[model samples]
Target chain A: MGLKIIVLAKQVPDTRNVGKDAMKADGTVNRAALAAIFNPEDLNALEQALRLKDRYPGSEITILTMGPGRAADIIREGLYRGADKGYLLTDRAFAGSDTLATSYAIACAIRKIKHFDLIVAGRQAIDGDTAQVGPQVAEKLNLPQITYAETVKSAEGGKITVVRRLERGVETVEAPLPCVITVNASAPDCRPRNAKRVMKFKHAKTVTESQAQSEDYIDLTNDRPYLNIEEWSVNDIETDMKWLGLGGSPTKVKKIENVVFQAKESKRITNNEEELEAMIVELIENHTIG
Target chain B: MGNLFVICEIEEGKIADVSLELLTKGRSLANDLSCKLEAVVLGHQLKGIEKQVFPFGVDVLHLADSKDLEIYTTLPFTAVIVDLFKQEKPEICLLGATTLGRDLGPRISSALQSGLTADCTSLEIGDHEDKKAGKTYKNLLYQIRPAFGGNIVATIINPDCRPQMATVREGVMKMEVYNENHKGKVKTIDVDKLLKPEDLVVKVIERHMEKSKVNIKNSSIIVAGGYGMGSREGFNQLFQLAEVLSAEVGASRAAVDAGYADHERQIGQTGVTVRPKLYIACGISGQIQHTAGMEESAMVIAINNDSNAPINKIADYVINGEVNDIVAKLIKLYKKNSK
Candidate 1:
């Protein structure tokens, strides 16, 4: 058995370049104004995990994501990129989940599944950038954790070796099995979606969900719905309701305001030799250039 | 009154410089809050760290010395800190936003069920009526960080959570005061074998440390190129200029994505946030993401063919020209002036 690795992925809005109309009157992000894409760094994490699978052949890569129905796009992306299997954890109860609550649900789902040799996640989700979920999951799962991993040097004989990017430099550490690693952007770029693999797994889905999608729109009646992903609700996860959602999230947004730059043109010096020298001298005197 | 806690970190038995930086910030916060400063050191039979904390203005040193705690693990670090948080209940907890602190802070806060704000640039104590109580004077710690990709500054407060938490980026603050008269107490905590060898899912098999070629975060001068550089060859010119000037090379988000250089050299909201003395942007349009990271630099010189670009708006000197020509000229000029 080569290593079995699982990657937890997320689909987030591209908030880096939002327009003036990106915010609604109620002061919440207008999801419509933003285009949804797989979180960029999460793709890096997925790529790192897939690279591990490639090195040690026979290793199976599983992708688990918790998002809305449309998040199935990420699963398609994952499958296209050589993930052996993709599982979606979707339900209405998981809506409005903060990092803590979301990590709880994912941990429960992971606990329900079979054991894996390793788990990987992006350093942080762009939407929140809390960077809390990965470590929190490791803590909840009782696994050793390493965040900001740029490269995985080796993994063999129940031992995993990786390079950790610290502020000043990089530190190489080898941790025991079943460790959770958070992939930083410094890692290798994720490979492009493989065309042949996409075609092969195009039809793959949970048995019931595939059948439901196969049904015609008119034939859909007031009948029982399908349980697609073995998704557990807040109760199904054996979680306290008080420890979920906005109620559980201690941080509150008193206000959400768009930051506007008050452009103050201090002094625009020319790039001439004298002017450049003078500007540098003045900046140092003002303690701005230092 | 609780003392400010500064967690000391060491790699290969050498004290990390950022630990000293945190102690400096902690001492100031302690003075503002009218409390003493404390340093928390955890490692394997490390007794030398105690003497060092004194120069850093630590009034009390909490030591957790053990063999199992040699390498940083989530369980031991969290377990030890949670115990300290319960016993001490410090007013503020600050950690360097390094790899270890990023991994450890959240778990500790989650275990304590407290609020933690990560990657903060500034902090202060705010005197306001307790929002929870509506009309009671309370000293709430205000943790401020650049959010929305450094376009906005968000001030976060943990009014209810004890030990209001925040992580500061390395090199963003000063080092602690090294006063010879600084006297404090050192209390050693026992990290008993609460965790088993089997419980650790991940084991350290081997370790490697690669010395970085360029420590951009600590560099005083940075020469950044962007997509407007026109070609990959043009970016190479910027690098040549960086070599001549003894400056770190940087790029905008588009430039990095375009394969001009590695992602580590990219400077912007998504990349490294930097504030160098002289930041020169060549052939780059100033998008918000790119601007957010470099806007804080002391003197920004934007060289772009298009004078109306946003880079021109924020730059102290807007060189309206082609980047390749301008960079080549600047290199020639610098060489001549140096002689």
Candidate 2:
């Protein structure tokens, strides 16, 4: 039997080339300044699922992302690759969630799926760098978690072998199937969008995204169910109100201070051999480096 | 609930450096909150190791010594700690953001229905306001960390959650041994009751512990490279200088992302936070993401072709030259001077 996989993806702002206006005066992120893209590491996780699907032939890949209504774009982006179906967990109730609340919301969504052989997630999001959500979801769901997974060696006889990248070196471990795996950036890069797949999924949109547009999707979704990226609000998922959003999120932003590094004066050093030698002697004498 | 607690990790019959660092930080925060600074140590036969926490200002040390608690497994350790936290109800909890801490911190926080902030760079005991709830919180743990890929800093607080928790990055705080002798409360809780047999679900078949040649975190000197190095082969130059100085080789995330170096050697917000005495930046453009990792170094030397590279701002000595040329000259000079 082919395995069922769920790839957890997030739409995060590209933070590599942040400019001056990246943060507003009040300390919250100025979303408009930075373009939101599929979180880079999530792509790596998706690649792992896609690779497994390739091996298992009939395996299915689903993308589950929790964010604002606009996060439906990540689902479409995943579909453009090789994902079969997508679930967008959205609602205003999920605002200001820390990793704990985020994982709770995600675990509930996974519960709704009911049956899956594996759940793949990025090791951490660049925005938070917490690396807690995937493992926490595993814990909340009472599933075994293999984190920092660089490669999935094999999945046979209801057992999965994964090679993990640790601080000192690589480690190979095996856990029974239906476990959670968090991918690291060291994993294989995800394949680019397929021309044909993009054309097929370009019109794929969540209900909210389709509602925002003037185009009518009533007939399209009825004819081609794949064009509909299913959306699940808090009400759709059986979630307690106390554990959904800001009230459930214990961590709060106390304050934010803008920091700018002031340039320190440095003595001009020439690159000549003589000056370089003299500077080395001086540094050695001062015990800077020997 | 007013007391602050630190989860002290033991390695090789002694407390890990990160645990000591958190103890030192916890002492300051405890002083600010006017409560006792307590420490919890769980391990097998942790007899004499519990005393070392006293000099660092731990008013109480709780040792849950057990054979099951050894080897740093997530199950029993989280069980014992969460059991203790439930009974003690500490106002704040701190641990090192290492592999064990990252795993245990979340489990405990999630189990208790509290909030946890990971990889914090700084901590303060202060007050905060809830903007949306229209309320004010007093005497909270202000956990500050890099957000948005180190582009901005956000101060997170667990205002509504009890026992606010945070995992601080290793080496971000100083670990100093106080010479003065002082008496502190040391309690050994019964471990058998805290850890349940059912909690052990995972088993380790084998653990390959390789001793890396470059223990960058403890190294006094570091030679760091960035994307400016161009390719993985360019890292050989950094390794050469590191070999000469007996230093560790490090890289920015850009280099790691570009497949130029392994992720373990990455030094930045998402990687290791090192405070080496001498840090030589080769071709590192020094975005805040990279510098935030090594900015605490005693001496920083930047060698980049661009004179206005961001690394130059924090560098004590800025050399406006190519890394290949400057590194060659420096290595030659050092070899010659030694001879």
Candidate 3:
């Protein structure tokens, strides 16, 4: 039987290419200054979902993301890459959500969507680097989770085999289906965007984005229902206001320090054992080594 | 209400090293906050772990000995920790940022609705004032870590939630060995009632024992290369030097990205943190990301053309020259001296 796959993705500010304005005065990320790109490992997760769709024929892939209104761009990018449709869980109440609250809100939205046999996401987001969201969602939903997954080897008979890339090496383990899987960066690179798909999804927009459009596209959106991306707000999803946003986030930033390394006075040495021996002996004498 | 808890993850019937580090660090925090330090060990038949952990400054050693916890699975371990957390509203909780901790800590904190920090390099007890939130918290766990991928060091506080949870990187804190003659109370926790039948969703089908790979974090000697190495051939010279020095080969993220090395060999913030005895750099302009991984190396010797490279800041000795030239000369000298 073909499965229903939900690919969780995020449009994170490109932290890898951080510039001077990447951090704000409050030590938080400056989302406006840096270019926003799809979280790299999430693309790898998407590739796994697409591969599973190819094998399972009728399997559907839905890209789900929680961000500001602009994050619908991530869903359009996913559509061009092979996602069937997407849901953007955007709300003012969800702002400033830490991992715990973020997962809580997302879980509420997932309950609204209702049907999903599998959920796949990147092992960790580059910006947060916490790797907690996927498993936290699994826990909230009481589902089994496989983290650091390198590949999905097989999926048959209500079970899925996953190869994990651990600190030591690799592990091949099998788990029951309807479980969550977080993919690693070492997994196969995602395929390039197809030109035909890009042309087809170029006009895709969320209701908010469509409202800002000068062109009259309401009829086009109504004619091709896939062109409209689903956007949900706090009111749309059944969630407690106390468990959303800054009110719910327990972690607080006490302080932040800007650190820059300055070089110490380096000694010049010729390539010889006498010089090396002398340095080594001094290091030993200084208790730096034995 | 004012107690520090360290989850002592047991492996191969012994407390993991990171657990000891947390306990050692937690003891000072407990003293700072005028509280007691407790360590939790969960497994089937712990085999006299209390005697080993008591000396680490634990006032109360809690054990949850059950068949379900022989090998760590997230569900059972999370159930045990959260159940204990609900009963004993500990102010601060710490766990090693190991595979097991990373998997279990989030679930525990989520169930408790507490804040959980991951990969914290430093932890302290401090006062937290949030101007934006308009509140001040006293005696909070200030979890410090290199944020923005090691570019900035940020201090995070979970003042609003009880059991301010944090997962510490291994080897970040020094382990303490207190007087073993001292006695502490030991309490056994029952986990049978806390777990649900549906929580047993995952079963270990097969566990193939692969030959344990050499971990760079534990390597006594490391020869780390960087982007300046130019190509794979330049990395070969570093390998030769490592062969002579009997050191592990590590690479900065740049070299790993340049396709000269594999991701496993990467030494940096996003990669692996190492505390080698000696660290030798070749062609590596040390960024904070790379240095954060191995800055604790007992001795650092940097060889780079750019004398002003940031890596030279922490390096104990700096050699200015081409990496290939220096590596070859070092290899020859090492061989000759041993002979």
Candidate 4:
């Protein structure tokens, strides 16, 4: 029998390529300035899932992401890369969520999806750099988790083996199926978007998105059910209001300050031998370096 | 029962440095809160582990020794810690943001429905008055960390959650012995009773913990490169300078991402924080992400072709020149002077 996989991805502000305009004058990040793209590491997680599907020819891969309506783009991107279906967990109740609250919402969605042999997610998202969601989801689901995974070696006979990359070394571990694995950047980069797959999923849209589009687009989705990406809100999932949004979040932001460095008085010196020697001599004399 | 806790990690049968660092920080926090500082060590053959942590001013040491925990596994370790916290009701819990802590901290925080902040740069006791809620929270643990790709700093607090949890990177805090003669009480945890068979679902087949070849955090001097290093071959000049200065080699996150240097050598907000006495930055533009880790260095020197590089702002001495040429000169002058 083929395996069932759930890949968790996020659409994040491109923090890696932040330019001067990325920060506004008030010292806050200008969200409008940064381009939102599929989080780099999440793509690595998707690649691992794709690899597993390749190994198990009959396996099906589903992409699940929780964000704003625009996050539907992540689902279409996944579809263009080879995922069979996708779910967009979009709701205002998910706003102001810390890692734990975010994990709770994602876990509730996973329960709704029900059957899955494995779950894969990036070790961390660049926007938050908190590698908490994968393991927290596992805890909420009461399943084992293998984090910092560099490669998913094999999945067969209800068991999965993964190579984990740690700070100083690597370890290979085995866990029974229906577990979570957080992929690290060391894993292979994801394959680029397939031309045929892109053409096939180009029109995929969520209900919220189709409502804003022309009637023809709605008709297209009705005719081709595959083109209608699943969108879920607070009402769609079994959730407690207390655990849905900012109220359920245990952590709160007390303050945020824009990074500003105090400029020190630096002594300028040329690259000439005389100036270089003088600087080196001063450093050695002061015991700064010897 | 309400106390401060530091979850210690074991490396090669000894307490890890990050854990010791947290204990040092925990001792001060405990003193400020007028509470005891407790520590927990869950591993196999943990005999006499208390002797290692007591010097850091830990008031109580909880030990859970079992063969199943000889090597760190997620489920069993999480089970033991979660079970203990339910009974202790710690006011604040700190863990080293190592591979082990990052994996276990979230699980524990989620299970207990508590707040957890990861990779905190600073932790302090502070108060918060929520005008909207018409309430005041006294002595909340402020979890301060660089966010927004290191373009900003955020202070996080878990006012309502029990045992406000936070994780700090390995070298962000100093590990100082509170008192060599300090002593603490020992509490033994019943690991078998707490751990269920389901906790043993994941099995470790093989683990190779290599002794870290680069000791940058403890090094007094560091020669670091950045994206401007151009290629892996360009990094060789940094190694040469490091060898001459008897210093360790480090790299910016950009260099590591470019595959010019190893990830372990990355020095930035996302990597190892360092406070070396002398930091020679070669070809580094000094983004906040990179400078956040090394800004605390006792002295800094910048050698970059761009005179306007942000690193030049923090450097004690700035030299505008090609990195390759300047590094060669520094090496020669240092060798001659030392000789």
How many residue-pair clashes does candidate 2 contain?
0
lDDT of 3: 0.83
Which regions of candidate 4 are displaced past 4 Å?
A: B336-338
Evaluation by lDDT, superior candidate among 1 and 4 = 4
Residues B265-319 of candidate 3 have per-residue lDDT tens digits of 8887666778888899889887677787888887789988887777888887888
For candidate 4, list the clashing residue pairs, or say none.
Answer: none
Task: Provide the TM-score of chain A alone for each candidate, in the order shown.
Answer: 0.81, 0.92, 0.89, 0.97
Q: Which candidate leads the pack in lDDT?
A: 4
- The CAPRI quality class of candidate 2 comes to medium
Summarize candidate 2's per-residue lDDT along A1-290 as a digit string, tens digits. 68899999999988876776887887667889998899989999999999999998889999999998888889988998999999999999999888888999999999999889999999888777888898789888877788888999877789888887766567776777788989988799999899999999998988877777765675677688889999999989978888878777887776666656778887657678877787789889999888
Model 3: CA > 4 A from native: A19-33, A268-290, B131-135, B209-212, B218-220, B254-266, B305-308, B333-339
Residues A16-107 of candidate 4 have per-residue lDDT tens digits of 88887998998888999999999988999999999999989999999999999999999999999999999999999999998988999999
What are the clash counts of all predictions, listed in order?
8, 0, 0, 0
Candidate 3 chain B: worst 10 consecutive residues by lDDT?
A: B205-214
- What TM-score goes with each of the models? 0.83, 0.91, 0.91, 0.98
Candidate 1 chain B lowest-lDDT run of ten: B194-203
Per-residue error (Å), model 2, residue B301:
1.7
The Cα local distance difference test for each model comes to 0.74, 0.84, 0.83, 0.93
DockQ of 4: 0.81
TM-score of chain B of each: 0.87, 0.93, 0.90, 0.97
